[model samples]
Target: MELDSEIKDRSRESPSPEVGIDGRDRSASTTRPTLILYSHGRTPPLNPPPDLKYDLRSIPNPPKNARDAHDGRSKRLREHLLGELKFVQKLDEVESEILEAMEAKIVETAEKLENDQDRRDDGEESRENGEEEGYESLEDEYDPTEAVLRVGCNCALGHHRSVAFVEELARRKWPRNWSVQLIHRDIDRRRGNDKKVRGKSLRWGGA
Candidate 1:
């Protein structure tokens, strides 16, 4: 999608990155659109890849022993990382990029709807005469609930830094109309071992 430059070019409106979470109540139905946030390790998911990626390798990690006791989902570990000033700055940067991408998607969807309406208007006369060509409609490609952005946050082992960052990101205020999905791909897969760790479901509040 050439997301960075292309999104900026197509977006007619620029929203501030500091916008707070929308307090409006929203349903998790097909009528509501989505914004996916993915957290992973060194290797990122290829299918349905992210529009923006943030590397968290530089963020300070907690103690080595902490990996055994806690993954990034732990509040203790999250605070440990957030305690660093540099990490907070990085988070701010990520938020700005995500907002910009979302704005682009909104603009693109509006344009698509407008174009489809224009096509229908032009074909009105032909339809009345029963001479309109059988052609696919642009409306078929429109999905009101499709995902607007897939943002990836990665670190050395998806268990720690990336998990914390993505979890924290989700808690922040977002547009009420947009739903955020968090995926910690490698959280169960630990380092130096292929064995998987089974744990309770990770809870995402107000997702």
Candidate 2:
């Protein structure tokens, strides 16, 4: 029954050397190749880290005060344009009314003048019809043909003959019915002849 003190002391101080089932030291054998376990049939689960999370509401929007100001400005501009349109329409109506009144006044004045002339013509016709027989009309006593004269001169005399002829006719009181018109030489040349001085002269002398 006596225990070995040395063996008891070694067991209490450290673990025993590992042994294979065959009674050989396990550490003295070669190491086994490392085995990597992979989950080939399933995809990796997606788990974004906490630091990657974002808050969209943190971004700033346009100021509410500025938006309200822009809306008010647009409304005022629209109202101003509408007011101007109304004013222009009223001005156009006033102008049209004025023009219409002026045209009417002009037409009324013209009609009145025409009526006055017609009344005067009627009165003169009636007076003429009431006259007695053997009374001559004033127009019938006046002779338009007596106021004109006709004279001719040879072409060789040039315009001088026409001027002299007019002077002589005037001295004889023939100018009262006559007027001189120069017949140009070029005009007669085109007609295969030379120009001759010709005029109309009227005289009160016996024929």
Candidate 3:
């Protein structure tokens, strides 16, 4: 059999390829997906001849001295496999570092997604509650025949405060658009029971 070096040179010299790991030029097929696995730099018995078409190479985790998985995806898969093998195989510091970083990155991504989902849920809940509670709305509380101008006076409170509020409104030259009437609250019980006395307490002005 031609040596691995002689085969490599022949490949460069000619365009024809019979796919074998050592014989094939690494540069020509760097982007192919197949992961040809080896143990201690030798092929396994079940391995097929090198010329077969293969995709998605599954590389076994490399030793600590084995630095830099040549292809990007290959490196990731190697590190992931190393992490899985941690319990079975005792890993060195270098392998431990790579596994730890990978784990941290995964955890961080999960936390970020969870926090984003929680914020969206909270915002939706707050919006629904505001809609239910009628937030910042005065329409339902408004009354066309109601007046809020009030003052408390134990003596003739309904008339005293009621009249004063109307006078204050006039002093300010407020718009007189609504009707106003004073409904005395048990004024007859406090003052004389005579019809004239009760009639004096009940008065009307304008809003």
Candidate 4:
């Protein structure tokens, strides 16, 4: 079936690509996976860590220019950071892993569901013969299509490299239909609290 039109929130001033469907019609009878992309810093751990986490601290920080560093969402900063060969290579590697992980998870879920169904079928026969208790129903079981692909990228500050990488990843075309939730967990962290560590990240400027 053809994909449904992008859903929009009426309260927003303009249509934002930040939230939208990636492929198939979610409203259709069949379910699809939802990929959550998170960008964060090292100080705090995510409540539930992503299934796959990529570290961007190895990638050198972008030039500290006021215009670009002042805003974490600046296109110029993204361009500068993305221009690095390391960044491109890392993105390609991460994308491939994401696809592999999602496909593996889907297959794993399908197998689990199949096994559950088989058990339930056997249990039903036993119950009919007054030999067994009630079995777990499909309603209480996992949905195969609900396989999740949670990916996180983190750097020193979570302002530039990690945030930009997640944003770029969120924008890419994926093989499967997905509902995406993009998050920058520590982008707005206060600079005052950040103690300057020698030879670590550049001076905390703006996120």
Number of the top candidate by lDDT? Answer: 1
Query: Weakest 10 consecutive residues, lDDT, candidate 3?
Result: 32-41
After superposing all C-alphas onto the true structure, candidate 4 shows an RMSD in angstroms of 10.3
Question: Higher TM-score: candidate 1 or 3?
Answer: 1
Instruction: State every prediction's TM-score relative to the real structure.
Output: 0.72, 0.21, 0.20, 0.70
Clashes of 3: 5
lDDT of each: 0.66, 0.27, 0.29, 0.64
Candidate maximizing TM-score = 1
Better of 2 and 3 by TM-score: 2
lDDT-better candidate, 3 vs 4: 4
Best-to-worst order by lDDT is 1, 4, 3, 2
Error of 1 at 140 (Å): 6.2
lDDT of 3: 0.29
Kindly report which residue stretches of model 4 are placed more than 4 angstroms away from their true locations once superposed.
Answer: 1-31, 66-70, 134-144, 192-207
In model 1, how many backbone clashes occur? 1
Output the worst ten-in-a-row residue range by lDDT, candidate 4. Answer: 198-207
lDDT of 1 by residue, 89-152 (tens): 9888888878777766555554555566677777786788887656666556666445467788
lDDT by residue (136-188, candidate 2, tens digit) is 33435543222111122222222222222222222221111122222222111
